[model samples]
Target: MFDFDEMESQNLFLYLSLLVLSITFFFQNIKPRLGRFFQPSLETRAKAAILSRQEVAQFLDSPIVKEQEQEQEEGISPSSTFDFDPYMETKVELVNKALDEAIPVGEPLKIHEAMRYAVLAAGKRVRPILCLASCELVGGEENAAMPAACAVEMIHTMSLIKDDLPCMDNDDLRRGKPTTHKVYGEGVAILSGGALLSLAFEHMTTAEVSSEKMVWAVRELARSIGTRGLVAGQAKDISSEGLDLDEVGLEHLEFIHVHKTAVLLETAAVLGAIIGGGSNEEVERVRKFARCIGLLFQVVDDILDETKSSEELGKTAGKDQLVGKLTYPKLMGLEKSKEFVKRLTKDACEHLQGFSKEKVAPLVALTNFIANRNR
Candidate 1:
């Protein structure tokens, strides 16, 4: 006899899981129209990795990676080697140059200056770097991905501006410097944020890629910032305030983080892959990998908030606890949060298994950095 009920239940569970992941930018109600735009142009895309010194000669010279290579030659730590500086140097430099040009000082001097100040500020450059790295990993020219990469940074800077406002996180410091609102008045800070947000899309439209790919990238970015994306996530977070653990719940917290943080990362990676001309399957694989890392970012943040101090973390430590914000450490124990990060890292790398090993090396190192960074 057929067990129709049991089979149906299993299928339903799988369907809902897929729906949650694929639809909501980060699990809210999905904007299917934008999601469709990022679909790969081909079924398969062949990619190459920087397997030797010759292959990486054009990029920045990474002393640490070179040292590791020397060790390999001498057969030391044969099973252990990783370096991300080369990947970071070119990316950070390029993104900074693009950013410098993206928002120049002009008439309406205050607005432009405010935008330039925040956009050109120092930070980890994580989002744009991810975009460039993803494109390179897929064997695409870094130039083709530069515009979108810069755009990603602009969006990130805008988010920080808003987050630091008295209305939001009320943060005073960022990247070891005063927040935009602290340097510029609240009015200027708000305008600067709005300008950067608009600039992200404007800059993407000007990327040298084909009209089709540019459109695709633009729509994906739109999806990430729209109603069911970052905005929704922020609203949820603010609204969830003062709610009990039982009220906000783990699922709700995850939803908030996914929408707020993960969606942008997912968009950044997907945009890079698409610009790099990845096939449909390859683009999807990268998105899944990025998705895991994006969520992992928040989890590690929660863990750090509990375990590190203000100086070590470069910001207020235990702020989440002080504010009673929902976090992995608060919901799950500190040990459990650490365990969750490990599993997420493992899952992130597993998605890249189909990629060229050499190409995915930067991402691998990046994942470790995110998991273990002190600040």
Candidate 2:
């Protein structure tokens, strides 16, 4: 008496029970292992925590955090801590000396003196240093890019002079000193600006790089200050001034900054890369990085203008408000503007990936310095 049906039922039950046990074992043991395998390590979590802030503060206060978080997330660690202050000091000295040599008190001493006054003033020298740093980042020597570096600074000084004219923003102070038009008559200041613009191209041609690279650098520099770049931004800015925010919105404001501010920064980096012999891809990468920081620079400027004192800013603080101009803080609120700063800083640093940490230190440090600068 085989009891065939009962025997079949018993086998089916046994099979079901074993399958259930396997699943339970997987959930209890193997699943835990799998979860642990997928989870990020404590070190990774700690690194990520660098970007977290419990309280909303000005973005400049935590410049190191944004840069460090970006680097650590990419598993990048410099061999040693990068001392940015000394690095900036060295670069500033180099640029200042070059600029002094570039513009001597020659014939027509008034224009040259005005040019020298504006160019040799105590600027952050952000544009020129960016050129040098970018050149070095692409394996070019500093000396090779020195000419272009000085050229970029000259263009920047020209813009500042023109920007402070009675027809423009009409500011009385710049770089902690009287505006160019204030010290020198507006006519002479205007002439000095024109002279610098011409000298910038001439100085750029003096670079010992190939003619092709020199041509490319010259084209980029011209476009930056032309109708396509700074001029475009300034034109829009002047047109939109005192208009209702609804009429001139964030998009409009961004257009102004992208041209008026970021264009030259983009040019500075692109010129450096070209002179440094970087490939097209590397040049574009640096361009993108500079664009982010360029816009970031304006956003930070807006924040500083709203919050810092005139003495603290080295320029007229609250001038944007005084002039009925739109700013990031006015449009996005201070907290949101700060958040934008963080985002821009993050984006800026991310572009530096794939380059050696040591080689890219100057640019990275520059980004942080720009982010955290008090003046």
Top-scoring candidate (lDDT) = 2
- TM-score of each candidate? 0.78, 0.80
User: Model 2: runs farther than 4 Å from truth?
Assistant: 1-72, 75-79
Candidate 1 ranges with C-alpha deviation above 4 Å: 1-82
lDDT of 2: 0.82
Q: Report per-prediction Cα RMSD to one decimal.
A: 14.3, 16.4
Positional deviation of 301 in candidate 1, in angstroms?
A: 1.1
Summed over model 1, clashes come to 1
lDDT digits (tens) for residues 244-323 of candidate 1: 87775555776777778888887899899989988767878888788788889999888888888777776667877876
Local distance difference test, candidate 1: 0.75
lDDT of 2 by residue, 215-298 (tens): 667767876787767888788888877887667555567778878888788789888998998987798789878888998899
